[model samples]
Target: MSVEGNPGRRLLDEDRLFSSDPSQRSVARRLYAEIRDLPIVSPHGHTDPRWFADNEAFENPAKLFVTPDHYVFRMLYSQGIPLESLGVARRDGGPVESDPRKVWRLLAENYGLFRGTPSRLWLDHALSEVFGVQERLSAANADAVYDQVQACLDKPEYRPRALFDRFKIEVIATTESPLDPLESHARVRDSDWDGRVITAYRPDPVVDPEYEDFTANLEQLAEMTGETTSGWKGYLAALQQRRGFFAEMGATSTDHGHPSAATADLDPAACQSLLDRALSGAITAEDAELFRAQMLTEMARMSLEDGLVMQIHPGSFRSHNQKLMAGFGRDMGADIPTRTDYVRALRPLLSRFGNEPGLDVILFTLDETSYSRELAPLAGHYPILKLGPAWWFYDSPEGMLRYRRSVTETAGFYNTVGFNDDTRAFLSIPARHDVARRIDCAYLAELVCDHRLDEDEALEVAVDLTYNLVKKAYRL
Candidate 1:
């Protein structure tokens, strides 16, 4: 019952059914065995670059495991645990937990809240494989598990760079704002370290009018790029310049986190007028959205010219909890998934670049219903469009399975980019990637067993889907 007493054992019993049939289960096990130790290709994620740049030993288990993870905190929040108690830092400089072990106990007490959730799978995997915890994280074994993890984390082997090497991560991408100077990225490059952790250009603050301090962010972008961000043409040029700067820093892609899957194809004059209204702060919510939509099209056009991959992650109702958002700020696990429409919303952008062979736009959605209805069909036909793997809310085992089942018929394995562990928790990278590979193997096993695909074909597709597809998709 204690992690210290019986180390190096699995939390769950082997009898647990991840797959239904014994034959398919065997195939899945074999398939997982092949890529189980393969190098991780984390093409897109939200992990802090400073962790790798600094290469400092993590302070404690709770801060490393519980606090920063939205999946962990959101579940705790759903069970009536205040975010402030879980050591979630406030944006307005309010007080929060300073004792990491106390936060760990609170999370351990409420661990059952995530029993059937993906968080449980990730946690168990991290505990067993990463920290070598044998016992399950119940209230009884919480302290023991915490102590063991804390002890291990205090070691130099558990440092970010060491773990990156131990995890066999080939490349990891951290998202960065346009205003960021990428000093950490520069440090990573200049250091003797061989780990390939790159930055992704996220232009939300400069592009999205609703983003906090949008005006100031625009001024900063202008200052960095020496382009007049006040005008429409100069704004676009500034963005292009910043994107080039990111490209030089090893960025192969640009990410847009828009509110919806909206896109527009406004002419130059209309775009300038919209920008003027937005700058004057006279733009309505609807106008702001339209401008964002138009920017998607503009970004795609730029991608076509520059050869950088484009990623659109739309349909998040970000900061749903107004109080939590106001107190703790963004990404405190208050963001909820809403139904996203891709068909009509992306028509403008697709119409302009859908047939273009030079452009590559990978689409990720929070709405599962759109997988077969919108995403698959779009990716199936458009030369420029490719479906990103199950993302964010849907980046679970069942979610990945659902994605394969739903989209495989139309988009196929080649049309879809392989898995990307888009996580902020650095330690969970291996666990998340493991879950994805397992689910994909299970899906392929099912296909092989059903006689839909031969064993040889399944093996090839599994390897490609797990490794090659992602590398090619992200231009790695």
Candidate 2:
């Protein structure tokens, strides 16, 4: 019998078909083959720009794969592996594992833990396709795979730009703080490399009062934009200035990672008073939230003015593991999904720009309950609104299917943006997109099988959902 840490064991057996029957699997496989090698269009993600800017060879398999990815670390953490052992950085300036080989061995020994998870699929694909590794990662093959991957890392063709080109990534967007100088992005542009790596303005550090060093961030914003961030008008202008700067760096979208979907549009005087209190550090937690809400509306208004796409991702109870958060800081995969209300919460911003034909506001949520109930209906009605794909915790095959099933009837295909891998794991980009394409084709195949749609139509819709829809939505 196959047990854990066996190199011969397959993570997914042939019996585990994505579709019910061999015929359906064959059909899905044909559909997947058509677009399997399509150039990746990563419109939004958390990939570090410095990687592309430097275009340096990756140090090792573990640092490239395990350390930076919360998905990998969180799973290890759940299995009682300390975050420090996983090389996760500590907030209290504590030490972490410096050896990449050790991290790789630890991750390899626990490979069985990712069974039945999307991580397994992604890892398997990377191992097979990227490293040419046929055997499963286990204690026996761990060092072998590590040495092979590390050897590849030392090669010139395995450098960041080389792999980016090899992966056929057409465009990748890296998220950046509004306070960022974008010097790395400038370096990328100046480089002879042709890879289109862009930046997206994430204004949370400056706009959200609860963010650490919020006051200092605002001061820096003022200095950067030459506007008085202490005043409402100047603050708004400073935000606009920074938005333009990001646009100059080829950013087409602005991302807001708010805690909730709450939005507001207070009058100028009221807004000014709120800004004053926030700037003075006199605002309560409630006021801070309200201010963030108003800023969402303000950001929409700015989006309309500048023609930048707006993405609002809300409803995460971030850093929920107080101990882990304290030890390893944010994005340790301790963020929990909560039930989010979009219809009522987004009313204030939608009321202002919902009917605007030119503006594009893409909405993403951690809450699945709101998909059909609120998000679909809202995106169905609003000219400016569109639904972002299943994100973060819900970016799985089931999650993708749920999104299509819940929202397709109301919002339909045109009202939704295409799949965004949204990963720090660079090698998983193609795998993630493949999963989405397969699930979409499978859904379309079901429609064909059920006689709800014809085979020819299903194929067309499959192509559109996988390729055309995302291009149109992201305006690429």
Off by over 4 Å in 1: 5-9, 12-17
Model 1, span 1-476: residue lDDT tens? 54645555557554343487899998888777787777899999999999999999999988888889998998888878888898888888789888988999998888878877888888887888888887778788778888899889889999999999999999999999988999999999999999998999999999998888888888888888889999999999999998999999999999999999899999999999998888888889999999999999999999999989999999999999999888988998878889899999999988888898899999999999999998999899989899999998888877888899999999989999999988999888888887888888888889888999998788888889889999999999
- Overall lDDT per candidate, in order of appearance: 0.89, 0.86
Q: What tens-digit string does per-residue lDDT give for candidate 2 at 1-476?
A: 22223576554443332588665676666666676677888999988889899988888898888988888888999989998887778888889988888899999999999987888888987887787677788887888889888888899998888988998889999999989999999999998988999999999999999887899998999999899998889999999999999999999999999999999989989988988887788999999999999999999999999989999999898899989877877888899988888888999998888899889999998999999999999989999998999998889888888999999999988898889998988888887887888888777767766777777777777777777877777777
Cα RMSD of all models vs. native, in order, equals 1.4, 2.5
Distance (Å) between predicted and true CA of 129, model 2? 0.8
